[model samples]
Target: MADTASQLMLGSGLTVVSHPLMYVKMLVQVGHEPLPPTLGRNLFGRQVYQLPGLFAYAKHIISIDGKMGLFKGLTPRLCAGAVGTVVHGKVLQCYQNQNQLEELGSDQKENSSSLDHVIKETTQEMVARSAATLITHPFHVITLRCMVQFIGRETKYNGVFGSIVTIYKEEGVLGFFAGLIPRLLGDIISLWICNTVAYFINTYALENGAVSEMKSYSQAVTGFLASMLTYPFVLVSNLMAVNNCGLAGGSLPYAPAYTSWTDCWRQLSLEGNTTRGNSLFFRKVPAGKSYVYAQKRFY
Candidate 1:
């Protein structure tokens, strides 16, 4: 009981610790929407490379108001974190109890193999996570909206209650569930990959005794691998969600509203291929880039 309580406390604390960093990440990821430079290039024969001026951008974001800006959308995140922790704990406890019952039952022991047991456990965890995600997804949307709501930026969403009300009025209930498909798919895949890799590493360490002091390093590496594998999907999903709200609030520079996931993919791919850069994302936006690339959509 004490150990369980300690684990819960640690998880809650870790969730809290992650918020400040998450806010910073959101700030950077959504803050800059580069416009194409005009008359400068024809280098690769297409528009590309719009720099946000890293030092200048940083300076702007770190000013007195900007420092506080780091915590812009923290309220809903903390609330969601608290609720999610409680739900996670309860779901885990339920699964543990069920497994214990299966272990104790003689007939069940004969019916299920180790593989079956593992599969069942994985399924249970995935379902639990999905449920929690659905319940808390609206909070996430609110968080993103609030985070991206800059001082001079035009946004209808304000405080938590105001945002909720605005979304309801403008977008209806479904607005809260924007990007549901990609978000769920990305989360499930990432969770599965992260846990599987972490499990293997942990088991190997326990068996071989090769890693002692480097456990934390090993875990960090595993986390990095998982994040890298899933980051593109997560990034796309977040942009989609942001765009959904943008559709409600009006035009946004980061991502215009996509009709569907396929449309989003098409737009991203076009940008990648048609743009002069080798990478999908351009650092500098040329003045003519938007007009040249986006003019077709106007029709």
Candidate 2:
């Protein structure tokens, strides 16, 4: 219980600190750029039009909605983080207990190889992660809509209970799970990719006595690589969370009303935006693509 409380507090603190950057990233993900590009030198020392980076985007939001506005969806996000942590812990504990019972009942534990243990642990983590995501997804949906509300200056999703009522009234219960599938898929795929790559590299590639010490960090390295590969799914999921959900940001000019998450994925792929919002800094508009900014204020 103490450990869980510490983790919850730590997770909430990180969420609060990271919310502003995440706010900017989400706006980027939804293709909302109220700020115009400025001429800046690229890494090659050539002058190029660079889209507003994190600080610029954050300042733009502050100008429109004040400093506190940077935390528009923070409440729900905190709730989601806390709930996810607790759910994952409970579910993982259950899985561990079950495994212990099975080990007690069977003699196969002694015969189980290291790879088998790795796979089993990975599978348990995947299951716990999926459950946590599924259970807390409603909070995720609310948090996303609340953040995207910045684009349209909509207050439809204000507080946690209020947002719940609004979603049920406007979009029904299904509204709470708008982007669940892709989020779950991204998480599961990333977990498997991380574990599989880590296992292979640690097992076969790290036979050197001194160099083998790096095996401890293999999972972290592979997890980073996996996140990079699965980032498009995350982008698509965030987009779907707000797509055509009766917000100006979800409509024409800001975004096309995507038929579904897959349709959103297809459109993003065709436009070479599968990796959009992947970077918070050094954003350069694609050559031949130009942005037209309208002088508009929602406040």
Candidate 3:
């Protein structure tokens, strides 16, 4: 029972952690409609209307989630949201690159808060969206971890997770939560989605009593449905964290430029990872370097 609770809590925490990234996603989906002046490009090609610099921010955030550390409580997330948004917004305003074209009146159009407007709006939207899901993510993280661990520690099956633990003990610990933090945050944002949909189902179930009678099965079913509803966060969070070098966030060393949440979503939708060359993650090579080094190492 205690184990179950922890898995639930940890799972939920991961979901909570993942919520912030999803905000970028929502903005990416609707944001293109607003930006008539932004020019963007990706691995595919040049785009006239694209999500600005939000993808870089998302990569940074995702990298943070991939590692193992004590300092990553919540401060990094808040800081990232606050600063990354402004940086991304300004960077997104491509008209600045056309500064030589300033006399054409494209750059002088900002009379209000400037490009920062989008950042503020986006950040607040993130907070609101994240806040909405906070109520549930922690529980899920703990629950899932506890569940897997319970089986891992006690069971003797030939499961892949179990085998991985046997082969790469350290990697195994990390892999169990390969995308741990982001997964949690993703779960957090997912509450908004799952709750909105499940509340009705839950109410219906309560009134029915059929599922309720088989309490354990019912709980499992609930967990299953919730997990399914929440997998989008899980998928994206995994992508971000898996590439991280076990530093501030689970960020990959080599990440492609991204425009916004839409780019992030579209990216993981096809290829779910950036790169697996984690050696460059924690260490920075010197100018004339034969090897890389790190002040602190996590594996």
Candidate 4:
């Protein structure tokens, strides 16, 4: 609990510091001097990069406590990046919807949505998009980190900071974003396929009165199906981010530490987890030991 407080403090403090930095960057782009990225600090960033130097450090800080600290920091950054992810997903879905409506010969000049279909589809799409976004946002960060290590020539130390630095040095901005095209392409498919499927499935369940309100059972099923359906994108995205060249593009730079999704899944799977399938409820099973069992289901 104390650690949670500290993590929160760290996150909140970083937020405060980052806001000013963002403002300053904006000012500089608007023709202001904007303070140099390196301010009055000891020596320079070379100390940050020096080999066999105490000054050099691992990209990620590991704690005896494990994921709590890292997750604390990631929560804020993940939320920021999600803004981009959602926009990308939504814009693609919009274009797709447009194309479908055109193919149906419902030119907006005559009639686009049949008013009722518009409202029904709109409601369904919004719910699926929201649910899908939550799962993707978290996994996106986890996978991105894995990619950094995969692409590395020398780990230097495990973590994102070192990897980011290496990427900047090697690829410049363009190279840093090498995998973006594939990701955007995947988004096109995810939005069109996943959204439409989820909407129809959920709509059927609701009309049949399968359950009250959206629940984890449905969400988990949706997440799994969407994940499996988009397996190709998942592979390509990881390849580009970690290897810089994916299967269709070039030979991958590194073999992923994980051989298969099932292998990675088992490694990450929490044993005795009743909550394995459910995201909202997880608690210790009432044994002598603390367990990962679902507060609602076994993990």
Candidate 5:
């Protein structure tokens, strides 16, 4: 119980700090269009069209909005994250208890192998994350919408309560769960990949004393790699959720309905030239220096 409590508090704090990075990444990726005016043309006055490069655009955001601008949608994101952490813990516990009960009743329990335990734990994690995603999904939509709105865009949704009320009024209850399927899919893949890789590292890479000391490092690496691998799915989910911010009282059109994950991927891939559409899954440079440069450029 103490460990879980500590984990929850730590997770919430880390998420609060980290959420803005995600917000900025999503905003830039989705807002890629009519290149920033400064970069739209070269010295010759001919249109030197280019897809928004990650670093240049990030610099632009910092320049125009100042430091605080990066954290535009933080409140709702923190709310969802804090509550989501609790929900994840409780749901995981419930599933674990159910699994224990099943093991007690079944004769196979006495003969259960390591592989069986691994599979059971993985299943519990999947269900817990899926349930948590569904419950907290509305907050995610609101956060994304809030983050994407810029100086010229509509700010129909104000704070958390205002956003919820507006979304309910404008788009109905279903609007709250706009990108649920893709989000859930991404969550599941991320959880599985991270857990499996971490477990493998824990088992194979560390000995008794070293294991305790290096556990955090191993887990961090696992998470980074997992996120990178599953980010494309997350990008698609974000597009589905935020493009449909129109449903939540914004100007962007609702993303076209996707009949299946493959269909969605196919459509998103074909819509823009390969580099522009697929750039969301990768980053060319860090934003810190860009933010400083941006501040200097605009302020």
Candidate 6:
């Protein structure tokens, strides 16, 4: 209980600090670029058209909605974080207890290899993560819609309960789970990739002495790589959450009404944008593609 409380407090603080970047990233993910690209030198010193970086994009938001605007949707995000942390802790504890009982009753516990133990732990964590995600996804949907409201200047999803009522009226219960499938797939795939790659590197590539020492950092390194690989799913999921949800940001010119998450993926792939919004800084427009600035706000 104490650990869970600590995690919730820490997570809330981090969420508050990171909400601005996330707000800009969500706009970028939904293909809403109100600002035009500027001439800038790339890492190699070659001139290129650079989209607004994090600070620049954030400044634009501030210009429109003031400093507090950067925190749009933060309340629901905090709620989601709290709920997810508690759910993950409870579910993981339950799984570990059940595993302990089974191990005490079996001979396999004495014979299980380190790799087997690692795999078992990873599996348990993945299950806990999936459960947390499933239970807290409604909060996620609310958070995304609340953030996207900046584009249309709409105030439909103001507070948590108000947002819930609005979603039920506009989209029914299914509204709470608009982008769930792709989000779940992304998380599960990323976990497996991270764990598998980390295991292989630690077991086969490193010396036994170094393997023990590197074990702590291997998962972090591999997790970054795994997130890069599965980022398209995340982009698709965010877009799906707001798409056709009666918001201008989800409509044509900003975004097309994706038939499904797969359709969103397909469209993004064709446009060479499966990894859009992956970077908060140093964004470069693809060659031959130029952004046309919107002359006025949607609402």
- Using lDDT, give the best candidate's number: 6
- By summed lDDT, which 10 consecutive residues of candidate 3 come out lowest? 290-299
**lDDT scores in order:** 0.62, 0.87, 0.38, 0.39, 0.67, 0.89
Of 2 and 3, the candidate ranking higher by TM-score: 2
CA shift at 108, candidate 6, in angstroms?
4.9
Q: Give me the displacement of residue 162 in model 1, in angstroms.
A: 1.8
Steric collisions counted per model: 13, 0, 48, 10, 0, 0
Residue-wise C-alpha lDDT for candidate 2, range 46-106, written one tens digit per residue: 9877889999999999998999999999999999999999999999999889988988999
Better of 1 and 4 by lDDT: 1
Model 3 Cα displacement at 182 (Å)?
9.6
lDDT by residue for model 6 over 129-245, one digit each (tens)? 999999999999999999999888999888999999999999999999999999999999999999888988988988989987898799799999999999999999999999999
What TM-score does prediction 6 earn? 0.94
Model 4: weakest 10-residue lDDT segment is: 49-58
Q: If scored against the real structure, what TM-score would every candidate get?
A: 0.70, 0.93, 0.27, 0.36, 0.70, 0.94
Error of 1 at 39 (Å): 21
How far in Å is the alpha carbon of 12 misplaced in model 3? 13
> Which runs in model 2 stand beyond 4 Å of their true positions?
107-113, 208-212, 290-299
Clashing pairs in 2: none
The TM-score of predicted model 2 comes to 0.93
Q: What is the RMSD of candidate 5?
A: 7.6
Where in model 5 is the C-alpha error above 4 Å? 1-5, 33-59, 98-113, 193-225, 247-264, 271-299
The order by descending lDDT is 6, 2, 5, 1, 4, 3
- List per-candidate RMSD values in Å: 6.8, 2.6, 23.0, 17.8, 7.6, 2.3
Q: Residues 61-126, candidate 4: write the lDDT tens digits.
A: 222223232232243344434543455355556757875787689644433324455444545555
